[model samples]
Target: MHRITALAAATITLAFGLGTGAATATATATDDAARVAPAAFSCSPGNFCMYSDWNGGGTRCQWPDERKANTADNCSFIQRGENVRSVWNATGHRVQYYTGTNYNSRVGSTPSGQGGNLQGSYQIRSFKPQ
Candidate 1:
């Protein structure tokens, strides 16, 4: 009787341990989902826009036509000499971005209907269809 009781208790402990582990994994997954940051911009169709802040916040500059050189003079954020930290490519073609004026320094490209945050050095100075 003593041995049987011990076995029952051990089995219950093991079952509870496994259940706790499963609960912990589910909690971790929920936390990860909550930590993901969602895109924060509303880009219009047929245009390309840049944001002064990451994930598309802050001032924005948009153009219907591809810009070989982003003057950014008319843009509130770029007018202050701040580079683009994020971009939304709403056009139907791939967009090549540059870190230098007149598309001199190629940085990266964004596919149609996509957007993302940029590296610190990849501040977009110009963009055109690829």
Candidate 2:
């Protein structure tokens, strides 16, 4: 009876240890995926571009129309639960970005011929000429 109990306890302990190890491994993988950097984006002249991931990677939305009232329903990035992490304004004029649809709640602006990464506060739901 003593041996049986000891064997049962050992089995339980080993199973618990393995489960914890697997959980840790899965968490590590998720962290690594989030930290992965996206590839560089190429923007053409006279257009504005937004990236779904940092450094101009992931899904891209470009516009030559100069104004977008709604991006949530049309943009692939928003569909994927991702926000604009970087931007490139190749247009001649500076671009104004807003947090809400239809250009409400102005957040920031990006200069023409320049681009940079965002800190995740401004998701860029709408944008237009400055």
Candidate 3:
């Protein structure tokens, strides 16, 4: 009777461990509403352009009239999954400038010209530091 009971207990214990082994595994994070804009966007930051709109200094990356075109000449940008501390790896882009409109019209024209340049101060949006 004792031998039979010991063997039965050991079998039950092994079965329990095998049955719930996956429970100890960690759960992964899932964001259903997340945006898939990684590796960068189509917004360009034209090289060697004027930025008189801010009444600021020269050598600005804002370009003449570039609003949104993938201009990776002088600078580059990167997107991240979430925001976090630790600047070990790049989490976001150090945008020389941003554009909400297409720069097709600004072609072959100066930035200070009529509708050829970007006007007003743009609100800089913050992203997670990857």
Predicted model with the maximum TM-score: 2
Candidate 1 weakest lDDT stretch, 10 residues = 29-38
lDDT for 118 in candidate 1 is 83
Cα lDDT of model 3 overall?
Answer: 0.28
RMSD of each: 10.3, 13.8, 18.9
Model 3, runs deviating above 4 Å: 25-130
Per-residue lDDT for 1-130 in model 1, tens only?
A: 9999999999999898787985654454234212221237557777787888888888878887866586464677766778788887777778998877788888899877667788744467778889
What ranking emerges by lDDT with the best candidate at the front?
A: 2, 1, 3
Q: Please list the residue runs of candidate 2 whose C-alpha ends up more than 4 Å from where it truly belongs after superposition.
A: 1-39
Off by over 4 Å in 1: 1-39
Task: Quantify all predictions' global Cα lDDT against the true fold.
Answer: 0.72, 0.74, 0.28
Q: What tens digits encode model 2's per-residue C-alpha lDDT throughout 21-52?
A: 74654454344212222226567667788888
Superposition error at 129 for model 3 (Å): 16
State how far residue 16 of model 2 sits from its true place (Å). 61
State candidate 2's TM-score: 0.65
* TM-score for each of the candidates: 0.65, 0.65, 0.21
lDDT string, candidate 3, 20-128, tens digits: 7444221110121111211111112222223322232222333332233543333222122111111111112222333322232222322111112333333212211
